[model samples]
Target: MKLHYSPTSPYARKALAVAKHHGLAIELVASNPSQNPAHLLAVNPLCKIPSLETDDGVALNDSPIICEYLDHLGQGPKLFPAPGPARWRALALAALTDGILDAAVPRRGQQAFPMDEGRSAMVGRFQSAMSRTVDALEGVDLSGPLDIGKLGVVVALGYLDFRYAQEPWRPGHPKLEAFYAEQMKNPIFSETAPPPA
Candidate 1:
């Protein structure tokens, strides 16, 4: 499999971590979506990082979708549970984590431009969403073997730390802080951590 990725992309890191956990042999192809590299565009019209081109020649995009595909081919316990309440919970957690990324990623990009009234309002909204999600995560059961939900949490929190270090998410979210610390020790995370900010 060939993975189009950037070292700094949390989404790419999540996909890479899943592949590594599965012990899959993947060829990493450096791609900068901002530059619209033709190879990346061929796999993902969105020009997104973390796009996977399977050995059979099928192209897949989106971190969750790619992770699920990798999980299906993995040898050990599944990251995604079989259809049941457990699956729903894991998926729900994944959604929440993605929501955090949905806000944070663009918010960070917007910082490159001059801040104005509209940008300020959008930034505030993003911060509020992230804050509420972190608060909600504190009350959830984060203890478990490695799973998609846990992976999402780890990657999401890691992204916050990498890009928003000055605005820490650790304060008042002790459970998440501890959970993240423990998860970071896992090779799946430690090895795939985004290049230092």
Candidate 2:
């Protein structure tokens, strides 16, 4: 499978991590969907990174879908639960994490739109929403092996590195700091680490 990706996209990094952690053989094809390239539109109408192109030429968009698809291919070391409360917990965390990015990614888009006129006040609103999400998730228990949801936190951290480095989110959140430092060590994350520069 070929994963359309940007080096600094957390969503793409998550897909890469899942593949790496499970020892799956997949290829990463760097793409800038933001550029709205013609060829990319054929694979994914949404024009987003982390779209997985199956061997059969099917394209899968969105990170959650990609992650679930990757999990389906894995034999062991699953990131999500089969069925039960644990699954719900992980899913909730994943949702919350994604929500944070949903807001930030756009704010990021606005800030990088090349013209201030293209930015919107709602972009700042979305950024505030992400901040609240970080606060809400700060109390989560992440003292053990990471669940898919826990990875959501790492995804957000990577987003911060990509777009919100000056946000001062970590100094007050020890739980997340400790979790991020340890989680970042997993080859899954380390290998796909974003290029902040």
Local error of candidate 2 at 149, Å? 0.7
- Tally clashes: model 1: 0
Please tell me which predicted candidate would have the highest lDDT against the true structure: 1
TM-score of 2: 0.91
Cα-based TM-score, every candidate? 0.97, 0.91
Compared with the true structure, what per-residue lDDT tens digits does model 1 show for residues 49-138? 889999999999999999999999999689999999989999999999999999999999899988999999999999899889988999
lDDT of 2 at 152: 83
Error of 1 at 25 (Å): 0.9
Residue 95's lDDT within candidate 2 is 95
TM-score of 1: 0.97
Residue 24, model 2, lDDT: 92
Backbone atom clashes (below 3 Å) for every candidate = 0, 0
RMSD over all Cα atoms, model 1: 0.9
CA lDDT for candidate 2: 0.83
